[model samples]
Structures are given as structure tokens and as C-alpha cells.
Target: MDLNQILAQLETANDEEIKSLLQQYNRENSHTFSFEKRKKACAKLCQSVLTVLGRQVQPSCQKTCLETLRILSRDKSVLAPVATRKGILGEDTQSEEEERVVVEALKCLCNVVYNSPAAQQVSVDVQLANGLCASLRNAREWHHEVGLFTLRLLFLLSALIPDLRGSLRREWRAVRLLREVLEHTLDVRWVGPYEAARPDPQALPMPAEDNERAMEVLKALFNLTLSDPGGEDDHQFRLIAALLRHLLMLKTETEEKQRKHTGDKSIQNRF
Candidate 1:
């Protein structure tokens, strides 16, 4: 029941044992495992979990470790080390397992920044914004899900720290990357895999998940604009155009679906 003992056990634990320890650590809400005991071991435990995350471990074990980090990130003392870790943003050519670890790391970072001012300060002090922007820029070639999680993290950071918006807007590459994603979404058509053989020029369908990811990018851009109004004039125009185009495409797709379902061509061309 001692937190230090748990930390020592976790250090040498196998995947199954690691998962068990993490689950028990996550559930330590009783008076026996008091807040003082947790605070005493929080940093060491978080460091151990982060070390595990850096290893070539099983995806499930990595996930459990990340879940533990997510919980520990609520403590201000743990945020700095977690945010400053080098390998948290897996390499561009990472395997699927590595990519999942990166996504979970981003999610853990997002939780760290959500409503914790201490964590926010640690993030800014450690230059976490630059790291997140790097992830966004590199994501063009990395896994799509990596980009999605990066955007989500940026959105949360911008929302939590008002000053971040100005800094992000000044990062021209990040702004440009968001614009490119929006433009791609505008060209997407909602078609399935079986229907992709013909390759319609005017209607190239993107996976629905891609569209959702693009929307997350847009949301981040919108959040940035709310605090930093001096986005480049050309980039601003492109963002607006891309948003309008995406909305029109969404409307057209919705109408097509309604027409097919209800057998009514005149389903209110209203938008």
C-alpha cells in the first residue's frame, strides 16, 4: 500500500504486472492511500511511467502507462518533466504501436493543460507550444491520427492559455499547415471504398475520419483567431474560403443523403 513500494514494483514489472499496478494506482482514492502519500510518490511514479512509455513496450502496456501519466499530470510537480520529455512525440516513421504511444502522450498533455494553471505555466516554461507545433507540421507525412491528436492538444492549449494564441499565430508554419488541412477537407467527397475505383475527378471522397480530423484543425485555428487577430491576410482569406467550401460540400452531401432516403428531390435547398 506504500506508494514508494508501488513505484519500485512498477520499475521491474512485466506488462501484465505493470497494468495491474497502474490500475491499482489509479484507484487509490481511499484514506489508507492518503493524499500525502500520493503527493510524496507522484513525481517518481510519473517518471517511471514516462520511462516505460519510451521503451518498445506492448501497446496495451504503453496505454496503461499513459493513463497513469494522465492521472499524475494533474499534479503540478509532474507536468514539467512530462512536457519536456524528448520522445513523447514519436518519430515520423514510427510503427503503429509507437504512433499510438505518441497519441496517448498528446492526450496526456491535453489533460495536463485543461484547467490547471500550474500545468499551463509549466507548459509555457518548457516551450511546449513549439513542440506541439512541430508535431503538427511533421504530421503532414506522419500518421493522420497523430495530426488529429496534435490538433486536439493545440486546441486545448489555446483554450487554456490565452497567451498561446498569439505565439501560435506567429508560427507561420503552423498557421499554414492548418490552412492546408482545411483546403484538403474542402475537396473531400463522401464516398465509400467500393465506390472509389472509378476515381471521379469532381468528387474524390475522403475517409470520414479525415474530415473529422480536418474539422479539429479548423477548431484550433478558430481558437487561435479569437486571441490573436493578426493572422496573415492571405492565410485568413484562405481559411475563410476553405471553411465556406467545406460547409457547402457538407450541405450538398447531406441533401444527397436525404434525397436518397426520403425519395424527395426538394428537401429544402435552404442553407
Candidate 2:
């Protein structure tokens, strides 16, 4: 169906129709669309999707709406303003109802943050990083997808909004958490007195979950240390850098190795 048909159907669409229309993106995303198409889709469907989410829909339907928005958010132009104005990024990211919904929302959020430089400025204005940090702190335990996406969002904020790094480090002490997460996720047992001694591992099977989370934490730390290390962070930087060194030394995943683990575990996680 075309955009107009999709929008028209969405207007009166019940749970299944809404899901079917939204699910189109699952395949469409694998191909590229023009800017005009994505912009048009975002302009027309942002409110449509949000309205569906606001209704007392079934958890399954709400999940689809959020997932669709997450996919569409790659447009990052029209969706950014509409999403921000709707208070999407500024709102409590952890959904009250369902964990999957929260994960989808966070993915949508990461897209908006990563794809739009304008969104970065808007996020800084709305103190989006502060909100993300608060949520990250509240999540003392890793809720897998939720925690992973939260770290990814924070990493995007740190990398995209250059001005926000110092505050993330000093104001939020975000570096400490990044350090802790990287260490815990990678089973990086520091050998020496402090982080000055980095992880040195031989053969390790990086769990899919740990691999993704550690990558995000590393990215955030790398972004924070882009400049000369501040006096307060010199030691921490050394430790994080050591972790990076260890990751780099990790043996490449052979083609056979990659083929072995090419299962549907990640696909199952979406639901």
C-alpha cells in the first residue's frame, strides 16, 4: 500500500490493521527510500502512530506501533520535531506497561538522536541526556534489552552532543558507570591495583548481549575521552583504554563461527 492508503487505513484501523500497516517497515527498511518518501511518511504517520499508542490498545498492538515508529524514526527529520514536541524523548523512557514497548521506544529514541543533528541540539535543550542518565542509574540490574538500548542512547548523546560530555562525566559521573558496565559485561577482571591493569583474555565467547552492551559502553567512553583527559578522569581513562585494547586484541569471528551462531535468538528478543 502507498502512504495515503496506509494513513487512511490507520485512521480507522483496528488492532490488526494497525499492525499490518506498520509491519510493512519490517521488510521496507531493508531497502532504501527517498528522503521525500520518508519525510512524507513521518509527517503523516507520527501522530497516527502516537495516537494508537495513547489509546488503550492491546499490548501487542502498542508494541507494533512503537516498533514501526522506531523504524520510521530513521528519517530523523520530521520525526525529530514531532517526537520531541510530543515529549517522546523528554518523557520517562521506561514504559509503565510493557518491557518490549519500552525497548522499542528507546530504539526509536536512539534513531532520533543518531540521525538528526537538530535533535541533538533539541535534546540538549530538553536535558535529554540528564533524563537518560537518571534512567540508567535507576536500572541497577541489567534488564538486557532495556539496559542495552539505554546505554546506546547515552552513547549517542555523548557522541552527537559534544558539549554534553563534560557534564556526563563530571555532573553525572557517567564515566564510572560506563567503566563498571564494560567491566561486568566483558568479564574484564582487572589484574592490577586499579584500572591501570586492563583485561587480557585468551579465547572468550562474547555473548550476543554482552558484546552489544560492551560495544556501546566502549563507544561512550571513547567519545568522552576524545579530548585530552581531564585531571579528574586520567586514571579512569587509562582503565577504559585498557579495556579497549583487550577488545581489539580479541580474535576475529571466523566465517564458520559466525555461521554457527546465526540463529533467531535476536529475532526472538523483539517480541
Clashing pairs in 2: none
Cα lDDT of model 2 overall? Answer: 0.68
Candidate 1 segments whose C-alpha is farther than 4 A from its true place:
1-5, 11-16, 23-44, 51-60, 72-97, 188-207, 227-231, 251-271
Writing each residue's lDDT as its tens digit, candidate 1 over 98-178 gives 667677666666766773576677667766677778766565575776777778877787778887777777754566667
> Model 2, poorest ten-residue lDDT window?
262-271
In the range 43-118, model 2's lDDT, one tens digit per residue, is: 6687777777767787777778777666666665557444564546422433547888778778878887777777
Count the clashes in each prediction.
Answer: 0, 0
Least well predicted 10-residue stretch by lDDT in candidate 1 = 262-271
Name the regions of candidate 2 deviating beyond 4 angstroms.
24-30, 35-38, 80-83, 90-96, 138-140, 195-204, 241-271
Q: Which candidate wins on TM-score?
A: 2
lDDT of 2 at 240: 64
TM-scores for every predicted model: 0.64, 0.77
Clash pairs (backbone) in predicted model 1: none
